[model samples]
Target: MKINRLLNNNVVVVKEGEEEIIVMGSGIAFGKRKNDIISPDKIEKVFVMKDKVEYEKFTQIIDQLPEEHIALAEEIITYAEKVLKTKLHEHVHVALTDHVSFAIERKKQGFQLKNKLLNEIRVLYSAEYEIGLWALQFINDKLEVQLPEDEAGHIALHLHTAKLNTYTMDETVSTTVLVNELIQKIESKLGVKVEEDSISYQRLMTHLNFALRRVSEGKPFDDVDHDMNELVKEKHKSAYNTAVELGHYLLESYEYVLPPSELVYLTLHIQRIQRNNGEEV
Candidate 1:
């Protein structure tokens, strides 16, 4: 392929047929310039860019990061997709690589940040958490530094964000905190403990997660049934009131306004949890 530009001595942008892509290999562009032909055997990794903006972002990351960091992050992402059986958003390439690079630097400087949502993430997103554990081991094996398991939860959040394409890393963390707070509110208002291992608890967590996603994206539940909503409120007054309070809590705390349909569903889930705990709904 003919070189379009060089990101660094180890990374080059090249053209193949109708597509422009980034290629990385050690010393592949050591003595090369624009329009130079790259040997096929010298290419180690090929990243396909979606547009000019993404191309530029990828180039900037390639220029600034150590080759090993980029390669390790890409390797973890690849393994995650294989195990999870899905294609993640392309933004993961830049986000995860940058995160890994910074994380490595912080560890080298003897700095560490604990992931507070580690338990919630491990329970709520078990699949991604498992992959995170794998990534920690992989990093330890490849880099020879034992990164804390809390980092596994952080990595899992990144994979989950990429899978959903909903929020950035920071937003994801905030959302997780909100969900946990909502659960606590439910327990306090309805006077019921939600056992994490129970199916009822799992359903409640899943529903709240997607409910928040819908609200944040400004997409409310469609085809709302007025009769059912009224029936749910009338039959389960305590649970319905708890849902209403939670809605106000979201609005006041996070500026999230829950729709009427969302409120109905939330009340039903709350009633189910209360009933599962042998408490009056």
Candidate 2:
């Protein structure tokens, strides 16, 4: 491929047909100017970025970024993909690299941004959270920087966003925060703690996740069974009431009203939690 430009000695932009691809390797573009042909053997990684803004940002930021930081992000992403068994969005290379670089810089300056959603992320996105924890230790071993566990939560969020591809960072954060809030509400209303690792809790989290997605996508729950809804409401008064409280919270926070069918399923889950806790449901 022909060089379009050089971002750094180890990073270069090359053109293949009409597309611009970022190529990275040690000394890949050393002593080379624009329009130089890159040898196939020198390339270590090739990033074919489709997001225009992210591509521009990646190219613009590389000059300021340490080569090791970029390499570290790639290593973490590779590990995450391997464990998660899914390919993340290419934007992660840019986003995670920028975030980790800034975080390391801030650490040297004696400041670390606190992740408020750390607990929620640990509970809601356990797999990604585990990867994030591994990344923190990997960063420590490679860079000798002891980034706090909160950084793990931030990293997990980035990985989660990339996995979903559809949810932006803001949406992912919002969803996690909302799920945490809903769980707290459930605990408060039912007077029982939902074990984060329990099967019932996982089911509740799964239902809440899809419910939020449905609401955000404007897909109504059209399979409302009035008889079942009324029976559950009557049989499981406390759980049904807690579900109604969660519904109100969703309505107020998200402006999306939960339908009766959703309430019924949600009530069942809550009742199961209560039953698991040895409470009268």
RMSD of each: 3.4, 2.4
lDDT scores of the candidates, listed in order: 0.84, 0.87
Report the CA-based lDDT of candidate 2 relative to the real structure: 0.87
State the lDDT of candidate 1 residue by residue for 224-262, as single tens digits: 689998999999998899999999988998799998888
Strongest candidate by lDDT: 2
lDDT string for model 2 (164-230, tens) is 4468899988887777778888888887888877888878887887798899888877586778878
Task: Check candidate 1 and list the clashing pairs.
Answer: none
- TM-score, predicted candidate 1 vs. hidden true structure: 0.79
> Worst ten-residue run, lDDT, model 1?
164-173
- TM-score top scorer: 2
State the displacement of the C-alpha of residue 130, model 2, in Å, after optimal TM-score superposition: 2.9
TM-score of 2: 0.88
Report the poorest 10 consecutive residues by lDDT, candidate 2: 220-229
